[model samples]
Target: MEIVVSISDMKVTSRAKDVIVTHALGSCLGLAAYDPVAGVAGLIHCLLPLARDSKAPQKNPAMYVNTGVPQMMRAMFGRGATRENLILKAAGCGRMMHISNQFDTGANNFAALQKLLQVNEMHLSAEDVGGTIPRTMRLFADTGRLVISSCGRSWEL
Candidate 1:
């Protein structure tokens, strides 16, 4: 099975398949976590930086990185994944635009996610972030492998 995730969303692919997430990312971010032993992989598309701005956590929780990361992890765990065994990696957070735009959503998004990860006692192992180009990220669940392609270049994470 293959799955594709949209912006500000997340998806967990089955152990027997691969997952792909795409699109133009300016300030948005993409996160992919996998448990190699269990063959479970998850992908999150974060639009903004943090979940702190919202008064209501449940409504539109995907809009914030803080809320979105945890939600994605919970969903993956529901499918029989262990937190300690999972390998976390991130991409996007591209500054395709400039930071002068109001609050600098791109930088804020990355900072928010980093803070959230710190609070959760988790840290990212691999990252391809903070560039001026967009990316297409793919995760292979069977092998717990990740591939990121951008600007005619590709790499494994």
Candidate 2:
């Protein structure tokens, strides 16, 4: 089974048959956390860096990196996954616009997610981020295989 995580959404599962996936990651971030021992996995598709401007966080915490990352982690932890055992990985955060002086949401999104992981005492093992191309991310629950795809190629993060 393939579970799609839309923008500002998240999902966690321990079923080996489920594969969590998220797409259209331009100027957005995809976060994946998995516990190999417990066979639990989660994925978050965050659209922004912060949630201070609106009530989106209160309603859908997965809309911002600040809240989404930790929220996704907790969902995984609830499925017999330990905080320390969680393997964190991220993708996307692409530079979609050519203007250098722009706000650069992708960079901000990456930085915010990094801070969140650091604050949670989580170690990010790998990532494929920061480019001028959009990408799709996936998490295989059975094997905890995280992959990022772009430009007609794909690699494990």
Candidate 3:
């Protein structure tokens, strides 16, 4: 079974048959955490950089990085996962504008993610981020291995 996760959304599962995919992550962020021993995994697709300016974080909560990251962690824990055993990985944060343009979505997105992770005291062990291209992230539950295939290149996360 394959589940598709959209931007600013997250999913966690202990099912061994699950495969999750987040596609076209340009100027966006893709975060995946997995506990191989438990066959549990979670994935989040974040769109914007900051939650500080969003009023929705107080109401919706799941719509922002500040709230969403911890939510994902809890969800994974519910599936019998431990914080120390989670293997973190990320993808995306690609720049969409040309060099002359001032809009640097990729850089800002990366910075925001770093801040969020630092606040939570977590960091990524593997990543394929920052470029002017889109990416497709695939999480295989059977092995707890994340594979990112983008711009004619494939990487093991």
Candidate 4:
């Protein structure tokens, strides 16, 4: 089964036949984590760096990197994924047009994610981030393979 993780959303699964994916990653963050031994995988697409900056109280914690990442991690752990065995990968965080450098949402989003991971003693095993093009990210639950695609090119992260 293929599970689509939309913008500001996440999905976690332990099913061996599942493939989790997220698309249209421009200025957004696509994060994937998998535990090979546990046969568990998760993917999260975060739109902003922080929930505190939202105009109103955000109902969906997955909408912001600060909240979303932790939420996704918890879900993965609940599904039998362990922090030590988790292989983390990331994609997206592109500098899109019409978005000024002063408010570089992509850069900020990545930075926030980095900070959060560091605080939790976690780190990304691989990543394909920062550019002007949008991307799509996919994670295979059975093998913990992360593939990132952009501009007609696709590669493992």
Candidate 5:
């Protein structure tokens, strides 16, 4: 079965047959982590770069890159996925539109995610990020395969 991770959301599973996917990633970012040895995988869709701006963490911790990525990682680790064995992949961080380009939210989101990953001692094994077009990201739990697609073209990582 396939699990759709919505914006400001995440999902983790150990089932080999499960596929975690997030669609229409424009300026927003998609972060994925997988552990092939444990057969565990997770996907997070983060909208902004920080959660500190929001007073209510319980209301939506998944809305920010800072909070969401680690939350999802914890979920993956709780399911037997080791930090050292985790393979990270990221996508999105697009310009998306020419109008209203004052703040590059995508770039900021991606940068914050990178910092968070580094602080966690995690590294990205693969990535498909930054463009004007939108994208879709998928993580296959069964084999820890990540596929990113855009403009009718797909790349496996």
Candidate 6:
């Protein structure tokens, strides 16, 4: 089964037949985590760097990197994924828009994610980020395989 994780959304599954995916990652981010021993996988797509920076009321925690990444980690652990066994990978964070350097949402998003992971003593095993192109990320629940696709090219992360 293929589970699509939309913008500002997340999905976690332990089913071996499940494949979690997120698409069209421009300034947004696609984060994937898997625990091989537990056969668990998770994916999150975040639109902004932090929830506190948003002017509107925060409805979904998955809308920001600060909240979304931790939420996904907790969800994965709840599904039998352990900290030491978890493998993290990320994609997206591209400079897709013609915005000023100060308003570089993609760079800010990636920085926020890195800080969050560092604070939690976690690190990304692989990442394909920081380009002017969009990307699609996928996580195979059965084998903990993470793949990133961009510009008609796909490769394991």
Candidate with maximal lDDT: 4
Candidate 2 residue 64 Cα shift, in angstroms, is 0.5
Residue pairs with backbone overlap in model 6: none
**What ranking emerges by lDDT with the best candidate at the front?**
4, 6, 2, 5, 3, 1
Off by over 4 Å in 5: 99-102
Cα deviation of 147 in candidate 5 (Å)?
Answer: 1.1
What are the candidates' C-alpha RMSDs? 1.9, 1.2, 2.1, 1.7, 1.4, 1.7
Residue 104 miss distance in model 6 (angstroms): 0.4
Per-residue lDDT for 68-117 in model 1, tens only?
88898898898888889889988888777554666777778888888988
Model 4 earns a TM-score of 0.94
lDDT of 2 at 13: 95
The 0-to-1 C-alpha lDDT of every candidate, in the order given, reads: 0.80, 0.88, 0.81, 0.91, 0.87, 0.90
Worst 10 residues of 5 by lDDT: 94-103
Per-residue lDDT tens digits for candidate 6, residues 85-151, read 9898888998996565798999999999999988989999998999798999888898988888888
Q: What TM-score, to 2 decimals, does candidate 6 have?
A: 0.94
- The sequence of per-residue lDDT tens digits that candidate 4 reaches over residues 1-157 is 9999999999999999999999999999999999998899999999999888664225899999998999988998898889999999988888998567688999999999999999999999898888889999989999999888888999988
Please say which candidate is ahead in TM-score: 2 or 6.
2
TM-score of each: 0.89, 0.94, 0.88, 0.94, 0.94, 0.94
Question: Scored by Cα lDDT, where does model 2 land?
Answer: 0.88
Clashing residue pairs, backbone N/CA/C < 3 A, model 1: 49-109
Model 6 residue runs over 4 Å out of place are: 53-58
Residue pairs in candidate 2 whose N, alpha carbon or C atoms collide under 3 angstroms: none
